[model samples]
Target chain A: MVPVLLISFIPLVRGIYIGFTDYELGGQISFSGLENYRIMLQDRFFWRSMGVGFLWTTVVTALQISLGLILALLLNQGLRWTSLYSVLMLVPWAMPPIVRGLMWRQIYSPDTGALNLILTQMGLIDAPINWLTSFEWAIPAIIVAGVWGEIPKAALFFLAGLKTIPGSLYEAAELDGASAFRQFRHITLPMMKPIMAAVVSLSFMWNFNAFGLIWILTQGGPGGLTRLPMLAAYEEAFRYGYVGYAAAIGNVMVIIISLFLFFYLRVQLKERTS
Target chain B: MQRLISWILYYKGFIIAGLLAVLIISVYIAGEMAIRLESDEIQTGPLRFLSLAWQEEAVAVVQEITQDWNQAHPEQQVELIQGTWNAVHDYLITGFETGDIPDIFHYESAVIVDFALRGYLADLAPYISDEMRDDILDVNWASVTRPTGAVMGIPFLAESSIILYNLDLINEAGVIAPTNEDPWTWDDLHIAAKKLTKDRDGDGVIDQWGTAMGLRNSANILMNQSIAFGGSFFYYDEQGDIEVRVSKPEKELIGNLARMLFVDKTMSPSGVGKSGAEMIPGFLAGNYAMVVGIGSWARQQVVENAAEGFNWAVMPPLKAVTQNMGVNTQTLSIPRSCKRTAIAMEFIQFLLSSENTTRLAASDWMLPTRQSSLEDPRLQADSTGWKVVTANAQFLSTGPWVGLPGYIEWKSRVANPIFQEFFSQRISLDEAAERIESESNSVLARYQVRGLKW
Candidate 1:
């Protein structure tokens, strides 16, 4: 415990402290109170990235949770090849994020990509669509890739939650002349609310901080349409050598995420108390 | 003895655990000793070299050279660590911060000034011999030599941008192919591009593009073109302070590029986002008639990846107002963190020796920096397009991207985004130039505050 604290905690605290200083990589360090934060507040790129980060997180989380729940419900039906389907669904989650990003990048290639070839062969369009290059479509394309990669994890969480629900409640509701939809609404959804909230909140936080997938795919390019705060901070620290300013961005992100987590914990506590 | 045996029998599990622990420790120590003995046999502790030459052929060449070095100097073997070019800079920076820097390392010439300014690199001027000083190209030599006249690194390989054209497309289109002696001007390229672009199926959509320009290094390529247009991104004042110069000529260059990409539509639609890697397959598939702004080293990639029986030719860099090419030189430097600077210097010298450098250049299709190596027939052979590369080398000018302390930030943050926006037609050329000038000045001001001047 002592060694772990020394290794991880000390650096984390030191990094937070660095937010208050002017610490360029390999340059002299000096304290300039609130200067980094002041610059960040006025920086249009920072705010733009924050907006992108929010949109990415919200869209990806919503899609992932919805798709995950649908898949969980289907898998719970005990259909044929359920085992095979379950295993196959986990494949994307099992793959490394970087590899997934690269794979999707190839698929999204404007020329000779699998997606373009398939779309063309289907006569869906007369020409290839620039999935990653177009400013209007780049973010949505990345979001699709992110959701595809994240759904399995969310499904697994919902699957566990589904298992904990009492089968007797559904059976009783059905016996009382409730339809499938009504049973799910009155019994399943109410029971799954706590788990759903937790999953959504956790997935949102994870997606907000997602870096490798986006970095590998578009590199936040084609006019910074997909430049999230994490990538912006990375560029500030490594490319620009503004370590202190990057740290302040990181701390700001932490504060925002903490607020979300705080509300989530409150909800969980309320549920437990009730 | 009887009492001890009885006690051991009473605590049989403890006795067994103690014995197992002893056996494991003994085995580990023996293994360590054996490894040490093996290393001692080769005397494997002289210089540690971290190289960014991870390409298969480059790695093979490095291995062969290291093997030769090991055999010739049995008492002092070199340890080589290899990484890809994309990840090496971060690794080098992290190594510097953590005091885990290798004795010698390979780096791109663009960031050598930054590292030297940070005091991470040692002054290598004293170690260079007069013969070596004479053999290295003047521009290559000047790249590593600081204003104070201290050479921080030795140039290993150099490359400049050239045009790779599909000869089949050129012949089919009946456009005159560019030559080393008389390369196409910007207007000629535009006309040729229009001639070469075709719609084979006649479905009102073009199936083949006349050319493609990669956006990954678009800023540097734009800088090269602006230089040819007689523009400078920056200039040093009499007091050696840097001033931003992205006004008229830079704006004109961006406008021309925008026309080529958005208006003319002769270039591939993928030009806005695709990297060189993504663009190469399309080029090989005959989707692009020519690939402009490709480094000389891409000749090896073209030879390996192009379709069988694909006929290709190299042309000298295009001209606008003047003919110039962006020279990208790879170099080796000894870090100040190295305890064995003398040995590291020796190893670097060995690596950059005429024969070794020639072998490396041939393997990677890069231009040799050494004058003696440049004279090698293999390097001058027309079959490898070295003739065009060598001829164009005369016009080699390191782009404004080099030697600036905040160059990476300026290029990636300010220049790249603005260029991308212009390419996407979200912003006009004038707006891009204005924003680039202001943002670039802001970046430079940060560096100036840190006492780094042009």
Candidate 2:
């Protein structure tokens, strides 16, 4: 407990304090309260990246949850080699984030990538499309990779939820002459609601703070189209030497994420109590 | 078999994780062992030199140089610590904050300037030997010298901007090959590119391009080579006034390059959002007759990776207003936190001696900063366009905006996006020029203010 408090709170408190000061390189910081915040308020890039962070989080989270639900339903059906299939599903999650980024970077390579190769071979494109570099396609391509990496964990959550739905409920519905689709609609969807909320909340925060996959994939390039808030803060602190400004950006992100989770969790609790 | 399989399956997760942990630990241990037998001990070396040279040839040469020093002076032994290009800045920042940056480190002059400005780098003006100072071109020395007259680092390796082209393609197009003495102007390049661009197999689509370049990361290229077109971009007057402009002279290279990309259709479209290094594969495949990149690419990429009989040659640095290419030398610096400044400087001087510097530069196919090293027979050869590569040395000048605080931010945040938009043809040329000027000025204004304080 002491170690945890020291590790977590020291940086946390230091970051919060730095956000109020005008800290930078050379260790010559003077406190200019709210000056960093004022700059952030007017900074167009910060707003643009914040908007992108939300768009990325919402899209990635929604898609992963839905895809996860589908995968969970399939796995819960107890198909042949069910255990093997479940283990095979861990491959995406098991790989390091950097490995995923590199793998996808190779897959998205314009000249020699597998994606472009398959697309050209399938006659989908007349020439190789620059997936990672093109302004039009870069964000969607990255989103696809993000969803692919996180879907396995989301599926595990839903799979656990699916297991607790009770075989008796399905049996009763079947005895009542309910169709497969009808039974799933009445039982699985309702039963999965709480787990869905938990998954959504967790995935939203995780995807919002994402840096590694996107940083490696794009470095927030093709004109800052893929620059998430983390990428922005990273540039501010490290690239631009604006440590205080970076901490301010981080503080803003945390506040935003917390506020979102606060209200979201409240709604979940309200429904559960009612 | 069944019992063994069951047992294995029961502990598979732990087994896999243990295997991964072992692999990582072993790789770390192997890297440590590869460096030295005593490297694992805390007293292995009193000094640590972080180097970013990753190429096997370059790494071997660097390791050999450091090992030689170690054998000679066991007391002041320097352990070579490996660093990567992508994360070096962040590592150095954290290291400096904790008062533990490398005793001696390798980085480009462009980047080391930031540290120097922040007072994180040691002043080397007092320690740099006169022979060493005179032997290196004054222009190379100018790159690492800040406005305060303090030399930040010793400039060592450099690569001038040059054009690499297929000789057969140039000959086939009936374009006279450009020599080091009489290089092509921007106009000459545009016209020749139009002539060389062809639709082989003639299916309405052009299969081959006259030239290709990855335009996405052209900020550094622009900063360096735009001087030839008389675009200093940032002009400093002796009166201590600064002017940042993006006018006709500044726009010439990008304008001609754009026309080649779109109007003439002589440049490859795939290079629109990529970098010159990324487009090298297409150049080697003979899909593009010419590739404009650093001189080192001709040596490293074309020499090492190209197919047999690729028939490639490099054009000397092109001339417009003049053939003055911007120089940003790869530098070795002593961090301010280091206790062994004198010893580190000596190690640096020894490491960058004429013989050692030449060998090191040759391994990486980069130019040595020292004039004596440039005269080395191995580097001064005519074969594989070495003559053409080294001939550009006379054109090297300290690039515009040298040692300017906030220059990195402007290049990355403002200039990169505007250039990417223009190259992708999403923005008009006038819009690009205007945005580059206005946005960069705002960024520089903040820097000017912060520079006074920090």
Chain B TM-score of every predicted model: 0.88, 0.88
TM-score of 1: 0.90
How far does residue B409 in candidate 1 sit from its true spot (Å)?
0.4
Compute DockQ for each candidate against the true complex: 0.34, 0.32
Local accuracy of candidate 1 as per-residue lDDT tens digits, B1-454: 9999999899999877787667666866997888668545433456777887756898999988988888998877888888788888778878777666777889877787788878888988888878888998888877777778888889878867778888999999999987877778888988999998899889888989998878754887777667787776877779877777776767766666666788898888677776665677878889899988777888888888877799988888777777865566789998876766777788888888989989988888888888888888878887668988777657877665567778777777788888777777788777777788788888778777878743
Worst 10 residues of 2 chain B by lDDT: B35-44
Best by DockQ: 1
- DockQ score for model 2, please? 0.32
Give per-residue CA lDDT, model 1, range A1-274, as digits (tens): 4445546876889888888899877777799799999988888889999999999999999999999999999999879998899899999999999999999988987776799999899999777788877888898899999999999999988888899998899888878999999988988889999989889888988999999999998888867789999999987877667889999999999898888798789879989999
Model 1 residue B318 CA deviation in Å: 1.9
The residue pairs in collision within model 1 are: none
Residue pairs with clashing backbones, model 2: none
lDDT of 2 by residue, B1-454 (tens): 9999999999999998787667666866886676455433433357889998877799999999999999999888888999998889999999888665778999998888888778898999889888899999989989988766789999999867778888888889899978987888878888888898898988878888998887878888888888888787898779765667887777887887788888988888988877778878888888999887555645687778988888888888777899888888999999886767888999999999989999888888888898998887898776577787778889988766888877788889999988998988899999999898888888888878765421
Candidate with maximal lDDT: 2
